[model samples]
Target: MSSYFITGVARGLGFEFVRQLSTNPANTIIGLVRDKTATEKKVSEELSGRKNVHLIQGDMVDYASLKKAVDEIATITGGKLDYVIANAAFLSVWAAFEPFSLLAKEPEKLEKELVDMFTVNVVGNIHLFNLITPLVLKGNGKKIIAISSGLGDQEMAINYELFQNAPYSISKTALDMAVAKFHAEYRKDDVLFMCISPGMVDTGYIDPETALLNDMIGKFMKYAPDFNGPTPIDVAIQRILSVMDKSSVEAGDGGKSLSQFGNKQWL
Candidate 1:
């Protein structure tokens, strides 16, 4: 039996991860969310009778809440955690569809958005990882996964000239490097730290009728001609778990940023 801790388990891919992982009755699943009562209600409504699942109230941007969460998780899992998935992040709609050139017109708003994204996406995860490393070191699985984005890839951005979502991409790129640095330090202890891209999962965030979204889709098509759209959430989670299961420090997977397909094929 393994113990897994995932953040932002209220909806989207985070919820899907808990849903899939908790299917195994022996697996202890601890989900961190900003609202405990609300997420517990959702879990009860949808994933009924899953006694192994637990929810903790915590916000990624709040260090005190995250610290308390680590203490609570220690009590729940007997001071050991097998897996820690850093999935909580901030995505800015203001910068989603525009390049930095256009976004720079509103300097104040752009600065705020960039700072907010970096705080939650990069700094917050660093705090979470630092707090949870001890528990992970004591556990058997010894794996840490950061959910990153393909848009952070420098080569891909330059090749396709994809300039949208600058703030989010910059934050994720920083997050990847942070994860790599953690891996560099922790690999000696056999803890596998890696970033995995979910590869454009459809979480109902995109409205097909939106002109900007369509324009992004056009850019994607230019990159991958056969790209129909985002993959289903369940399929994406399955592929990610498969990759995670197959990866290990001994196999040289530590410090690497891999896609769900276990390589650089983003979408």
Candidate 2:
């Protein structure tokens, strides 16, 4: 039997992780969402009678909430946690790259964007890891997976013209290095830390107010040419889980950022 804890389980990739992982009766799934009342009914309705799944309250930017959730999880799991998926992130903000450039007139806005992005994407994940490391160290699996993005890749950003969403892109790059740091510190203790890109799965979060949605689609087409659009949530999660199952420190998978295609072809 294995125990799993996933954040941002109210919707999107986090919800999918809960769905797929809960299917196995041998696994116990604990999901963290920002709003308990908001998600309780929906999760109960969708996952009816799935006793393997449990929901708790958490917010990525709020370390106190996460610590409380982890304390509860520790009691429930008896101090053993097989996996901790740092899947919660703040990606709701999108801005053009040029606007956030060094020469931009509005330095305040750029600073605010960077601060917001890093608070949730980088600092939050780090705090989560620190709180949960003890339980992970006690488990046999000892794996930590942070959901990252292909846009964070410096080379890919240039080649694919990923000039939009500068704050988000930059934050993810910082997150990748943080994961590497965690791996370096914990590898000796048999804990593995890594990041994975979900490969543009569409979750219907498009904003019609700004051209960001359409602009992103157009840029994706230019990058992949043959690519149509984002992958289905279920399909993307399945591939992601496959990669997670295959990862190992002995194979040099730890401390690396990977894609759906695994370590060799990072997104």
Query: lDDT winner among the candidates?
Result: 1
The digit string of per-residue lDDT tens for model 1 on 151-245 reads 89998889888998999999999999999999999989999999999998888776767788877778788877988988999999999999999
Query: Where in model 2 is the C-alpha error above 4 Å?
Result: 96-106, 207-211, 264-267
> What TM-score, computed on C-alpha atoms, does each candidate reach?
0.98, 0.92
* Poorest 10 consecutive residues by lDDT, candidate 1: 201-210
Instruction: Residues 97-165, candidate 2: write the lDDT tens digits.
Output: 343565256777777878999999999999999999999999978999999988788887787676777
Q: Report RMSD for candidate 1.
A: 0.8
* Ten residues in sequence with the least summed lDDT for candidate 2: 94-103
